[model samples]
Target: MPFAPEKPARLTRRRALAGGAAALGAPLVTVFAPVSTGAEDQLAIRSDILNVEAMQIAFDEDFSTLDVSAWGPGTRWIAHTPWSGDFGGARFANPGERSPFRIVDGNLRIEARRDPEGEWQSGLLASVDPDGNGFSQQYGYFEMRARLPEGPGVWPAFWLIGKDRSTATAEIDIFEFYGDKPDGYSSVVHVWHRDGRHYSRFHRNAVFVEARPDAFHTYGVKVDPDWIRFYFDREFVWKTETQPEHRQPLYILLNLALVDGPTRDATPDPSHMIVDYVRAYRLD
Candidate 1:
C-alpha cells in the first residue's frame, strides 16, 4: 500500500506556511481582552443547547497515577529512537531522554538536551497506532499547562488526529511555537483531503504577552459544532468557524518536531517541552 503523495489533504504544512506572512494576524485573531469581571472567568457556556462543563486539574506527582488510565488499554509506550539519542535529532532536543518525555518530581517533563552522543534530534511520541485508540470526540474542551523549549528549529505542538492519519478530516493545532520566536505562539485549524486544499485558510495568531519557556501557561481548545477556539493562559487567541467536518471524532496528539528539508537550522543541543497537565471537559 504505497502512500500516494498526491492525495489531497484538508491542508498541508507547505500551503499553511507559504501564506504565513499574510495570515499571521487575521481579524479573526483574538486580542486578549484584559481579564475582566468575574463573569469572564466562568466557562463561556452556549445557551440552552448545552451546558459546557469545565474539567480542571493541577498536575503534580499524584497526577501521574491518575493519567495512566487516560491512555486506554493495550497501549505500548514508545520511546525515543537510539539514533536520535536523548538530545533528540538534528532539529529538536529533549533533556533527560532523547524524546523529551518523562515523569519525575511530580510532573510530566518533556525536555530536550544537547546530544551527549552527538545525535541532535528532537523527541516525538504519538499513540502507537493512533487509529486504534478507539476514542475520538465531536466536540469538547481540551486543555494543558506546559513549559515550552526555546531554540532555533524547535517546533513544539499540541494537536489532534482524525481516524485516518493519511487523509485529513480536521486537525486542530492548539499551540505551536518555534525557539526563534520566543514571545509569540500560534494556533491553527486544518481540514485536509480536498484537492484545492484549503491551506491558506489555516491561520496563525500571536500571543502579544511574553510566554517564558520556564513558566506554565494553560493552552486550551474549545471545540463545538460551529467553531473551534484556542486559548493561552486561559485567554482566547484565535478561532476557525467554517468547519466542514466538525462532527467527526478527533483524537489527541502532542509532539516536538524539527523542520525538515533544505532550510533546516542548527539543531539545539538539548531542548524540552515540559507539560505540567492535560485535561478534557464535556457538557455536564
Candidate 2:
C-alpha cells in the first residue's frame, strides 16, 4: 500500500522537463488514424479493434448529486482508496458536513484547505471501495474533464489500479499535476508486485505538456491489449506497452492533494479542482 504513482521525482521529472513540448507540432496518429482525404476532419477506423469514439459509455458522473459514502456497499463512490493507502500531504477526509467536496452548479469541486488547527484536509474519491464494491472494467477508456488549481503545494491526479491485488498492483497514472509546474503534468505506469521486486526505478514514467491556466480540458487514457495511450483534450500525448500485470479489472480514482513542500510556498489558503465529469467507456 505504501507504493503509489507519486511524482517519480528523481527518476523521471527531469526527463519530463527535458521532453518539453515535443508532442506539440507532430500529429501522433496512434491507435486510430485520422485519414481524411480532403475537407472535414474524420478518422479511418482500422479494421482491427476499438477506438474512443466507437466505445460505449459504461459509467458517467456529472456530479449532479453526491452519491458517496466514506466506504460503500451501494454508494456510487468511496472517500478513500480501496487499499486504505492515502498519500500526499493532506489527509483524505471522509464524507461529512465538513467534507472538502461540493457541487457548484454541476461540477464536483475538490477542496484542499487548512483546518482550524492549521492541518490540511482534502478530498479523494475512488470508484471502488475497500470491499471491492463498485464500477470497474478489464479494459476501457477513462476520462475526466476539469480545470486544475495552480500554484505551489497543490497536487491533483486521476489514475487507475488493477482490482485483484493477490499478486501485484498495476497502476496507471493518467495525470498528476504539481502546481509548481503549471505548464505540465506526470503520467506513470507501475507494476507493484507484493515483494517490491517489480517496483523498479526504471518503471517510473513522466511527461510534460501545455495546460492553459483556468481552462477546463479533458484528460483521458485508452487501455487495450497492445498499448495504454494518454491524451490531453483528446490529443494523443504518449503511450506505453500494456503491462501483463494489468490483467484484472481496474477502477477510477481522483484526488486534490497537497505536497509537503517548503514553508515559503505554503498551500493556497483554499484551493480546489473543478471537475465537470468523470466517465468510462468500453468497446461497443
Best by TM-score: 2
Query: What's the TM for model 1?
Result: 0.65
List, in order, the clash count of every candidate structure. Answer: 34, 0
Give the residue spans of candidate 1 off by over 4 A.
1-73, 76-99, 113-117, 127-131, 164-167, 194-196, 261-267
Tell me the tens digit of each residue's lDDT in model 2 across 171-270.
Answer: 7878877777776777776665544333311221233344474589888888887777777777766566677877569999999877644621466779
CA lDDT, every model vs. true structure: 0.51, 0.72
Each candidate structure's TM-score, on Cα atoms with residue i matched to residue i, is: 0.65, 0.79
Clash pairs of candidate 2? Answer: none
Best by lDDT: 2
Worst 10 residues of 2 by lDDT: 14-23
